[model samples]
Target: MTQPVTLSVPCPDRDCALSLARAAVAGRLAACANIYGPVTSVFTWNDAVEEEDEHVLTLKTVAARVDELATLLQTRHPYDVPAITWETCSADDDTLTWLADETR
Candidate 1:
């Protein structure tokens, strides 16, 4: 059985987040993408602490598509280093079926 996962990416703005979401869904790399934000993020970059407002993009896909999705995000993302991570999850049978069908 294919493992379902959610890929999380941080975007600098809504436009960028939406663009990535559309491309991923269109390309069949993801079944769905959820965009949320203007959330404040605090982190250290290049040896300095920084804070910024960002959007969170969550992509639903199977484990099989993760590499391709990550590559697509890297090519399309606006940031120098985009944060792309995934979490394994359990879903209902109907949701899993829908996700597989949509991504395929």
Candidate 2:
């Protein structure tokens, strides 16, 4: 049984987020991608404090394809060091089935 996962990524803007989302879904690297907009993020970068409004992209896929999805994000993301994170997810059987089929 393949494990489901949710990947979290922050993009500079809506366009970038949408582009990544489209690419992931089009390539079947992810079953779906949810875009959340213009959220304020404050963090430290290069020893400096920075704050920005960014879009968040949430990608859903199975564990087997995570490496490929990550590679896609890493190569296409604009940041010098993009933050890519994911967690294993629990879902009902039907949802899992749909996810697996979409990704496959």
Candidate 3:
């Protein structure tokens, strides 16, 4: 059985987020994607504390496809160092089946 996973990628703006989501889904690297916008983020970068508004793009995919999806996001993302991370998840059977089918 394939494992379900969720990837969280923070983008500099809404357009960037939407572009990543569209490309991933269109390429079947992800079953689906959700974009949340204008979230305040505070972090340390370049040895300095920074704060900015960003969009959180979440992708639903199988573990097997995560690497490809990450590569795609990295290549297209606007940030010099884009934040990309994933987590394994348990979903209901129907959802899991749908995810697997869509991704494949």
RMSD of each predicted structure: 0.7, 0.6, 0.7
| lDDT on C-alpha atoms for all candidate structures | 0.94, 0.95, 0.94
Worst 10 residues of 3 by lDDT: 74-83
Clash count, one per candidate = 0, 0, 0
Candidate with more favorable, higher lDDT: 1 or 2? 2
Candidate 2 lDDT over 45-100, as tens digits, reads: 98999999999999999999999999999999999888999999898899899889
Tens digits of per-residue lDDT for model 1, 1-104 = 76899999999999999999999999999999999999999988999999999999999999999999999999989888897999889999999998889888
Q: Which ten contiguous residues of candidate 1 have the minimum total lDDT?
A: 76-85
Badly placed stretches (over 4 Å) of model 2 are none
In candidate 3, list every pair of residues with a backbone clash. none
Estimate TM-scores for all models: 0.97, 0.97, 0.97
What's the alpha carbon RMSD for model 2?
0.6
lDDT of 3: 0.94
